[model samples]
Target chain A: MSFVDMLLRAEARHRSRLCVGLDPDPARLPGRWRGRVEHLYDFCAAIVDATADLVCAYKPQIAYFAAHGAEAQLERLMAHIRVVAPEVPIILDAKRGDIGSTAEQYAKEAFERYGADAVTLSPFMGFDSVEPYLRYPGKGVFLLCRTSNPGGDDLQAQRLADVPGQPRLYEHIAALAQGPWNRHGQMGLVVGATYPQEIERVRAIAPTVPLLIPGVGAQGGDAATTVRAGWRGDAAGHTTGPVIVNSSRAILYASTGDDFATAARAEAERTRAALWV
Target chain B: MSFVDMLLRAEARHRSRLCVGLDPDPARLPGRWRGRVEHLYDFCAAIVDATADLVCAYKPQIAYFAAHGAEAQLERLMAHIRVVAPEVPIILDAKRGDIGSTAEQYAKEAFERYGADAVTLSPFMGFDSVEPYLRYPGKGVFLLCRTSNPGGDDLQAQRLADVPGQPRLYEHIAALAQGPWNRHGQMGLVVGATYPQEIERVRAIAPTVPLLIPGVGAQGGDAATTVRAGWRGDAAGHTTGPVIVNSSRAILYASTGDDFATAARAEAERTRAALWV
Candidate 1:
């Protein structure tokens, strides 16, 4: 199936816009599994089992595993999902960007190594930096546009006073990605929920491109506002595609106790309720 | 010894501005070692043996190893260097940028896992992104300011219209790195040698900070111009203190024949001689 179609179906089946982010910071992991991969796997597996029905996708940050020198474990973790939650989309949260050959290597790593359904890319290197990933059918690429952090405004929001019309850099990136890089239509924009205004503006620019909305839970973004601002209000009036709301810390670290899975499920249910309403 | 002092001493003793880049692209490896770690080890060891005296530092791009699922080989490659050329500074070429917590993990990888004297950083997330690496004493942090690629100018050279008096984005980054982020004075900038004019401008902005000049040889940068633009000019306008010129593919892949080491050594010696004169 096409990446978009797959996402839409997943969203409908789950009746949820929630995306569980598996950002396993070892320091924050509960109980005796602090540095152990088995403990990490158990924790992640339990969470997946509990919240699988509530989320449309699960995003595993590659750095977390690479940090542990447990690349093999990461492969195992992804393979386990292939067996367990085979229906849910897996978006590997690796913000990689490079030119030509190097970008190809990263594309292979995210797609071939871990077998992620979609991958987050750093569009800082321009459109070609994203082209290699598009070659793979049924895979999606999320380009960083308006980020969630405070300092995101530093370079992203910087305007070209020297240029004629004074265009914001992020808008230029959005236009370029939408125009040329979206040839395969598998491209998406990572518009952080923290900036609703930027989200609305970017949505207007790249109306068809999907928006991977991160920073909802731990980053303190309001779910309703994000959906409303991000939702496409075209001639269809009630827009209904290309936006996946993501929540990481709130669901992943719901409980430090042995009943962590139960707590995670509760968190997922709460987030699902908050979104569906 | 402190990273800055060690860099200075290494530069003086080597009597060459060369910095060899160890980017062992798996696809580009010889057919004999087509699909194996031992082949990578042999290739890297040969390069180190041939070029240790000709260069001040060895830079290994982490992406090449990470792409091949040769994470174990990365540690082995660095250890190989420690055994062969212990005095040659190892600058792990990882353009890592993340939040405070994640940045610490990257530092541990570059410092503890690979045992690099310095690591190149991508300053996309602002000061907080690089602070974790700088906190470690006797370690060098070379932040990406202006890259050599065509599209690099898209964002790095952006100017804010609202803030008319503000410096170009890269200039602001250079200043910030030199200011608060330069805790140990071990901070440096990776200003590509391709941009000689920008190199001169950045040198003025970051006069005291060390510069890691890449883009020589295969990248089409003139060695003489790079040395003049980066180093200090005395009364007779002679170049001075701590600048390492890097050349990767041009030397390492100088030959695909059995005399590959001899070819690599010849290329390194040629590059070294061209820069000094």
Candidate 2:
């Protein structure tokens, strides 16, 4: 299946757009797992088990695992996600950007080695960097659009001259992804939930493409506003345009006790409810 | 010492500006090592041993290693580079870009775990993604400016209307790297060698920051043009504006035979001589 179709299916099955981000910080691991790299798969798998039915997708930040030299454990966590949440898609949050053959290798690492359903990429290197990943027929690539960080304004918000309407950089990227780049409908944009206005703008530019909005819970973004701006549905509530509102730190670090998984489930449930609203 | 200082010291010590990119592809590995992921470290280390004294830096494309689940081998190769050629700086061609804590984890992966002297970053997410790496003093980051790939024109070559003079995206990055964003004098720009005019433009905008120019050999970028456009120095032949010209596939696969390392050295020597000219 195409990744968008898979995302919509997960959304329908779970009845939610919440994507629990699995960013396992070693310093922040719960209880005995704290500061221990060995428990990366264990902690992430437990969280996956707890929230498997509560989310549309799971985003595993590869850097967190790679930083600890625990890629094999990440491989295990990815497999664990597959077994636990068979229908839910996995977005490997590896914002990789390179050219030509190097890009091909990164695509392989994300799709072949890690079994990611979708992977994030920095669109800075343009379509050559993106083209390699698209060769993986059904996999998706999320280009960073209006990100949540203040520094995002440095480049993303700047107006592009000579492009007919003088669109902002993010708007231009949205238009490209919606038009020329969406030949396979396997492309998406990552617009921050914190920027609900920009989310609305991006939605206006790329109406049908899915939007992966992070920063809903812990990054001080208003969930209801984000959903209103980015999410689109038919009268029967079937998705017309998809949205994946991701919450990482808020869900993963909900509790630093042995019952951390349970706390994470509660957080995921609450986040899903909030995104639904 | 700052990364630029280290780059300059290495350049002067080696008497060449060439940076051999250690992008070891298993499919193209020489002779007995062909198509063997287990030999990633062995192939790269052999190349380093052969060319250590002939170059200013060694850049290992992480994607090549990560694709085969050989990040451990990458760690070992990094250690090998440090041991065999301690004077030559190592640039981790990760091109990683993310936000907040996620970006911090990526930085730790590059600087701490991998022991990279410098890292390449895609500036798509802006300064927040770059800031975490900057936190580690003495480390360096080379922002992707005007890449050699054709698709780079998609976003990088666009003009920013709102900004004064309507600077192209890459030129705006050059100004920032040469100005406010480079407070610690630790930032550089990655301008591809294929576009010598753009390299010259970047040099004009950021006269003193080190420029990591890739796309030299196998990618069809001219070494002499790249050198003339990007590199600058004072009368004593001491560094003023530094440049590290990179060539990957041409050097790594110069000979797909038993004497690959020796062939690699010859290619490195020819490339180094070309850059010097």
| Top-scoring candidate (DockQ) | 2
lDDT of 2 by residue, A56-96 (tens): 99999999998989999999999998899889999999988
Model 1 preserves the real interface contacts to a fraction of 0.37
Error of 2 at B201 (Å): 0.8
Q: In model 1, what are the clashing residue pairs, if there are any?
A: none
Question: Which residue pairs show collisions in model 2?
Answer: none
* Model 2 alpha-carbon miss at residue A110, Å: 0.6
Evaluate residue A43 in candidate 2 and report its C-alpha lDDT on the 0 to 100 scale.
Answer: 91
> Backbone clash tally for model 1?
0
Instruction: For model 1, report the TM-score of its A chain.
Output: 0.94
> Over 4 Å off in model 2, which ranges?
A234-239, B234-239
Q: How many steric overlaps are in each model, in order?
A: 0, 0
Give candidate 2's whole-model lDDT: 0.90
